[model samples]
Target: MDLIGHVRCFVAVAEERHFGRAAARLGMAQPPLSQRMQRLERELGVRLFDRSSRQVTITRSGALLLEEARALLDRSEEFLACATRIKDGQSGLLRAALPSGLARETVAAILADLHQHHPSVELELEELSTTDQLARLASHDLEVGLIHHPCDVAGLELGPVLRCELGVLLPRASLLAARDEVPLASLTGLGLVLFPRADAPAVYDDLLTTCARNGYTPDSLRHGQGDSFVHGLILSVNAVAFSPPDRGTAAGSPSSEVVWRPLAGAPLAWRYSVAWPHGRKDTAIHAFADAVPRALWNTAAVSTDPPPRPLHLRPASEYWL
Candidate 1:
């Protein structure tokens, strides 16, 4: 009775909950699978399963053991794969999704480094909204995501990689264009362009609350799905909006038709994070997460700022243009 064989049988039975199904999955006879389990119980001096005529269930000990077993198996596989890759002198692929708000050139710079250093490794990039990034990560559609903070999605973990202050984006010819920055209160009477609730409910709510605290409700002229669309709306109308500070390109080329002024009176800032499924303990995920901040460091525009204080503590000077 190999110890590893018994461990596999135990995990199979725990997951399938039926000896016959577990044996089928393991490509063995039911009697041998049952014997393996019984031998395991004898060795451990505990019953791992509760079997009735109608159904089979795992005992409390079995449930706990299952977690440890799975972790052990995952590590073993990872070790073998890493060894194989190193022997072959080849790495694997990293699939990632990113939110549009992150500076595009910053992402490009990171990808360039990965490509140059590990030519054998491949990266697949997708442009998704923050909400889409969250959903895809949970469903395993993406291994890692670059996203905004304040995500409430279950079964996901986040770490802040970079922070940017939100600034007002207005048309150059708009009445608010003369100032370097405008306070939230000054925009109370103005129509605003905001992200659609479906695409970014958290951002939308934050904007609403920020305005409400300033004693005004913004009149939304349109709701957009992404920054490109939002910029389009700004160009077409007198509507104003807020965005991260790295809104310009790497060369600091400003938008000709638009003027971005720091938001006055308690500035609002957004934290961009590296997010993945909580259950995912893959090497690739860890590598990508570790690489993100370093990648940002390679590009000077992206900075890791301390989390901003509560909207109230932010002074008018912080929002200066």
Candidate 2:
């Protein structure tokens, strides 16, 4: 019977008090509109209007049904609005995890842009390591992750690696600090602070392979568990640690005791990427992916050389950034 359509026809007739006027308002012929109202009354088993040759008037049953009919139309509109919002990634929450190792400014820029673009997307952020981000993401605890490694997890996929060149951070009082740029081989026998290989195997191994490739191998490797501890280790006057050049200077200030020097003839890098669970399609995920800027894809500011092995990339063209 197209129940809602019939009810709307009846409501129009009741309001207009004339079938001719109601049909004109509904943009339909008077005969078809009259038939629709008659069909609605038959379905409800009640007379909805008192029809006379002069005018039309609503019955008690029609008055009672009109209030419910209006509420139903309002609810239908509200439902459509909510469904459209979900499809467009406009009104849901996205739980995203980021690594503590990402350049602070890099993280800040990404977050700021996300807020501006997807303001309705409630962001619940967590600072996790790359390994932890992958695990939590797999379990569905997180919708998106900004991780620095493990780009090849079984259930995860990503776009081009966000690569950043590595530089040596040292005490300003040390001999190595005097150089504008330090060669990879020059730090071979010095006390070097590094991430424990067990913490991030692929990333840590890549750095080691870079050192060995340049004909230099650290004689002393102080495996620091965290960046704060590693930075403190490098501050001890002898130990040197690798970091991205603009890392600590993101706020435009360098530490008085620490000086940063670029690595010569080397391609030490921090390779990171945006990753998510495979086959998990969600609008918030799509919005987050698109919000990330194109500039972040290449953080390799100092080195013209490539990684020992090219980073694996899966282009995200279908997502429409």
Candidate 3:
């Protein structure tokens, strides 16, 4: 047996204090493990395990060897992980774009997970609107997109669709802010702040359609881009805006200026998906996609067959707005 394998067997037996348990842990038979340990002790010219009818105990030399073996195993694991990260085509950069107004913890959590799994992967993140993300993805300029659902771009597959319900972000002074839940119709007379209809049609259309379906429509929606900007309008003005639910607005200890209230009557839910272009089959893209947790998402994939003919797709011109 190699030195590492011998050391592994010794460490497992020492820790388990039973040859049977150590063999089970190692997925080996008892006889081979016992033989391996004996060989290791003979090679070292010192006894490691003191065995009797009832029990097995580590000797003085075994205790000290245990510490060194564990350290060596840990270093070996790190070395193997380093090789895996940089060996395959995974050792490159992944350029990603994310839309604003996502749940506060979304980006940080994803980045943290990616770092842990693939330390060699370098990430470049951009805060582009869903529209821009679609455009860049089509041209192969961007590798991954954390975007809103209902993305209509061709040649890209959507996946791990996450459900994010919406809440009303209202100023503290508004009458509706005092209620635990705000009725959909309560927003009828209030000013509404929205992303430009073109930027995120899925979100914009869904917001308007849900409101209209429930017998209430905003008289006029002032177009704005960016979650922070829309939120600013809500905070400083007597306006209502769509916000992701449960992010310190609706719960106890509401913010000083803005309060979150769930939209009652019609279910207000939005979806998010991690998008990547099809047929590219890039390792880094798949790695990033795999790193995202599946707990909160329902994945969907479009076909890999290329579109038949050349067709014009929408350019992300509104990205600057």
Number of the predicted model whose TM-score against the real structure is largest: 2
Give the range of the ten consecutive residues with the poorest summed lDDT in model 2.
312-321
Q: How close is candidate 2 to the true structure, as a TM-score?
A: 0.71
Residue-wise C-alpha lDDT for candidate 1, range 147-185, written one tens digit per residue: 765555567766555756677887777777788668777
Better of 2 and 3 by lDDT: 3
Worst 10 residues of 1 by lDDT: 312-321
Residue 272, candidate 1: alpha-carbon lDDT: 69
> lDDT (0-100) at residue 224 of candidate 1?
68
In model 3, state the lDDT of residue 290: 67
CA shift at 260, candidate 1, in angstroms? Answer: 1.1
In angstroms, how far off is 259's CA in candidate 1? Answer: 1.1
Task: Give the per-residue lDDT digits (tens) of candidate 3, residues 267-298.
Answer: 66656667888865666777677665442332
- Which pairs of residues have clashing backbones in candidate 3? 160-299, 161-298, 249-260
Cα error, candidate 3, residue 49 (Å): 53
Error of 1 at 99 (Å): 0.7
lDDT of 2 by residue, 1-321 (tens): 677677677778888999999999999999999888878778889998899899888889888988888788778778889878776667667788766656655667677777777777788888877767777888889878776653456687664455677788777777877787889888866777776555555666666666776866766778764666776777763678888777645321354676778888546777666677888566677666655534354332523223334454333212110
Q: After superposing candidate 1 on the true structure, give the runs of residues whose Cα lies further than 4 Å from its correct spot.
A: 1-83, 86-90, 225-229, 248-255, 297-321
